[model samples]
Structure formats: C-alpha cells, structure tokens
Target: MTASNDIDALAAMLLVRELESALSAREDCGFQLLSSGQEAVAVGVAAALLAQDQLLCSGRSIAPALARGLDPGRVMAELIGRASGPCLGRGGRGHLSQPSAGFFGAHAVVAGNLSIAAGVALALQARLDRSIAVCLFGDGACGAGALHETMNIAALWQLPLLLVCDNNLYSVSTPRAAALAPQRLSDLAAPFGIKACTVDGMDVRSVRGAAVALTDHVRSGGGPAFLECVSRRFASHSTSARETRGQQELAADRELDPITRLEKALLLEGALSTQTALGLREQVRARVTAACAFAEASPLPVPDEAFADVG
Candidate 1:
C-alpha cells in the first residue's frame, strides 16, 4: 500500500517532506498549513496525473505543487513571496498557480476551489482535450455547500473532474467524526451516483491505485468520481495553530507517518538498501538546499508590483 513497488513514488514523497521541513526551519517562512503528514496523499495522486491534467488544491499547497512537477526552487520562492516564483510571488502560499504547468493553483478558502475546479472541468470538456481536473480538498470543506453543488453539476454534466478529499481525520482542532454526520465522507458522492471509494491516505500505493482508477474513469468519459483518503495529521492544524493533542496521542500518530511506513517496508523487502535509502535522502536534501538558496537569492516584488496584476 505504500508504493507501486516503485522507488520513484518514495522519492517524490521524500522530496516534499524534506522541502517542507527545510521551510519549517526558516524564521521567515510565513505561517503555513504544512502537509507534514499528508505527503502520501499528494504524491500518490500526482503520480496518477497526466501532464495535461489540471490540479487544484487547498491552502496546503506545498506538497501538491511539488508533487505535480513544479520547479521546487520556484515553489520555494512562491512560498516565501519572492519575485522569481511562478506567479511572480504575488500568489504566495494559498494562491500558487502555474496553469501552464497543469497546477491550476491552490485556494486559501476551504471550499473555494471546488466550484473553480468544476468550471475548469467544464472548460476542459468543451475543449475536448480529454484531460481532467483533480481537486484535492480537506475534510473541513466536507460541510461546504459548494462541494455539493459542484458534485451535482459535475455528475449531471459528466464533467471530467475528480473530487479527492484528503481527510486527515481532524479539521484544525476538531475531529472529523465529531463534525460530519456521514459514516464515510465518500458517501456524499454516492447520492450523486458518482463512483466513490475510501482508501488509506497514508499509503502511497493505495492512493495511487485509487487515483489511477478514478482518473481513468474520468478520462474515458465516465464523469466525475470521488476518493476519500483517510490519513492522519502529524502537526497541529497549521504552524500558527496551537497543538491540541495529548503527548501519548502525538507519539501514537507519529508511528503512522506515511514516509516512515514505506521506508521501513521497503527496507524489509530489500527493495531499498540502507545505503540507497540514505543516498536518496541526501540527493533530495541537496535539492531542497539548492531550492532554498535559489529562493534566498531571488528578490522580493517591488511595492508597485502589487498594482501590476490587478484588474
């Protein structure tokens, strides 16, 4: 469940994890919704995506953007509000978009990108490109009206959109089970007759398999689909949010870290040797370092620059 028995998947997951870790250590790194524990969900879904497909995500954009093949250096720049970023750093964290790169961008609003994804899907359907739009949202957005309305239209029109809920169990400080009524979040899609399934978000292979199947269904004109990835959040909701979990609970959750899970399993199978694993880590660390250097050297936007992209 951790991988498709593929080292590439493992590598991608590590890259994001490390890149974020580097950012976390920086004093200037603004408040972030670090995808510390949800790397598997982003990497797994990205693995199944085609270059032409568009990916829209929530504010936790670092992992998704990196997973979708954006330049890590530029992503780092964007995260830190540098002029060298893909959106000229104006988009910042929650608004990093490089549509030409197939990353439609991330929305800071919980359910904000849901309808936007539907619109993108409709446009894709009109263009007859057969490419799809994948929207990665969190469990907190599950209660939004936009999701339901978008689902209804996506199902009715058979738009090539995939709704993936990166359900990390807790929405900020509140437990998902406490806020939502459905036994399974995927059940919300069932009423629309959309194909749906729930998988282990912490397992890269599981998420990849489910994403591939659902993306295929959308590609073949099977309309929209929904995938719920049940995962755990390692950190408090955000860098700015206070930790609400107890010490024992935090220790237990760390045991489920997706990266460690795959790394341990692969080591046991001899698919990955200690030397190779260490090498991969070093390689990714160098990449993150290089990215950091690039970001640090890049200049910030001039004050007037803010008026440039304005309507």
Candidate 2:
C-alpha cells in the first residue's frame, strides 16, 4: 500500500475499535455492533471514493460512515438516541445518514439498499457526471431477490455502481455454505456481465487495491462492479442474538483481526513504531470515551419533534 493508503488503513482500524468500544459500553439502546472484523472493506472502499461518491452501508454495520470520517460524537449520539445525532436521533445506528459527507445512510433490511443504490446510480448517470454509488451489504444478502433485480438493472443501464459484499462467512448463525449456493458470491454478477472479484477482506492493502481498480473501472464507464470480501465478524450478529459462538471460535476469528494484521504489517515495513501504535490505540479509546460522554450529556429528541421529519 502507498503511504496514504497505510494511514487510511490505520484510521479505519482505529475507528472500528473505537466504535466497538463505544457500542459495548453504551447502556441505552440495543443497537447492533459495528462491523468488527470487517473494517478493511469500508476503509479501503471509502479511500478509493471521491467526495461526490455516495456510500450506502448495511444494517449491521456502521464502519462505512466512520471510515468516511463522520464525527464519532454524532455517531455515538445516534446510538444513544440523542437529538444531536446525524438523523436527529430518529434513525439510530441502523440508519445513519450524512449526505454532506456522501454517506447515504444504512438500511436495516437485508439487501434493502441494493435497489436504492441502483436508483442513485441512475440519477448520477442521468446527470452525465462521474459520480458513483457504492452499496455495502453482507453475504447473507446475496440470496435476496432485490440484489438480483438491482444488478440486472444496474448492468442493463450500465450504472456506475459498486456492490461490496462483506462476506464474513456467516449469515447470523448460519454459515455461508448453508446460506449461499455459489462458492463465490462475486460469481452471481457474471450473469449480468458485470466485472466481479473476491478479495481478502482481512488485508487492508488487498481490499484497497481491488476497490481502487474497480471504482476506477466503474468511473470510466466500464459498468458496475461487485467485490466479495471474505472476512469474519468478531461479535454476535446483534445484541439480541442468543448464540455468541464458542470461545474457541471467537478466538479463531480474532486471529484474523484486521487491526492486528495491519499493525504488524506497518511495523514490519517501518511505517509505524510500536510506541506510536499503542499511542494511536489509546488516542482512539479516549476519543470514544469523550464521544460517549457527549452523547450522554445531550438531550433526548423532543416528543413532538418525531412528527417533524416525517413526510
């Protein structure tokens, strides 16, 4: 990875760590955890995107917004249901929208954002500009009809859209082998004539390389692309999930932790020192603590205001 890519990877890792810490410590709502082990997807993809590009995140992940540099304080506020959040505390963690930052928001329904991303790409195509839309979903969503329909239209219209699947090997508790038929999720795009590939989601550099190449291809009018990132989730599917997996499984998953992998790579490459790495982790922890404090101090949304944003 380039120097800038290395730095971006570090930022993404730190943001993921901080978000996880904040969510675990949050006592309010039972919001889903951020994409724990899948930080590289958001970081790498967002790094390749232009300011005009729109990013749509999955329901179970908030790492995309943080990767786009959205303020953690606002993110925490949303999780805590504070009025100061990006959605004015209405959407919570599952539906964070910061259009100014090109974060289109996350969708809670499986494969729900795929069609919306295609529509956004259609609008971008109509504008005759180079802007693109990126939809981030999970492996579980690959089987959804909406994804198939969206890919069909996206390819037919040749919309500049990038579909990123965070294939963490599990759809909730069911393994990918049980949920998806095709060995590779990217293969689904072949029927639509869209360029598709799978990447090592645990490696930030690998993800960045693929994302940059694919985004450039789409931007240059090569049609849409699909990237399947093979990674793992370190936490339960959600707060309500009854199965946490066995301790051995959790430990095995952590062996591929993106943060640790990147840290070791950077250290070996002389890009970061051990002391600096520790300091960065500490800094992120402090930032998360402050953001949580800010969220706690903020007022709840007014009862009458709930009817304001409603259309």
lDDT of each: 0.92, 0.86
For model 2, residues 1-311, the per-residue Cα lDDT tens digits are: 57657966886778777777667865665757558888888888888999899999788657888888788888888877899999998888789889889899898888999999998899888877799999999998999999999999999989999999989888888889988899799999999999999999988888889999999999999999999999888778887776647999989989998888888888998988899888878888888888788888889999999689677
* lDDT, candidate 1, 1-311, per-residue tens: 33344688788889988998899899988888888889999999998889999999999898899999999999999999999999998988899899999999899999999999999999999988889999999999999999999999999999999999999888888999899999999999999999999999998888999999999999999999999999888878888999998999889878888988889989998889999999999999999999999999999999999689578
Return the clash pairs for model 1, or none: none
Taking every candidate in turn, the Cα RMSD to the unseen true structure, in Å, is: 1.5, 1.3
Candidate 2 lDDT = 0.86
TM-score of each: 0.97, 0.96
Give me candidate 1's TM-score against the actual structure: 0.97
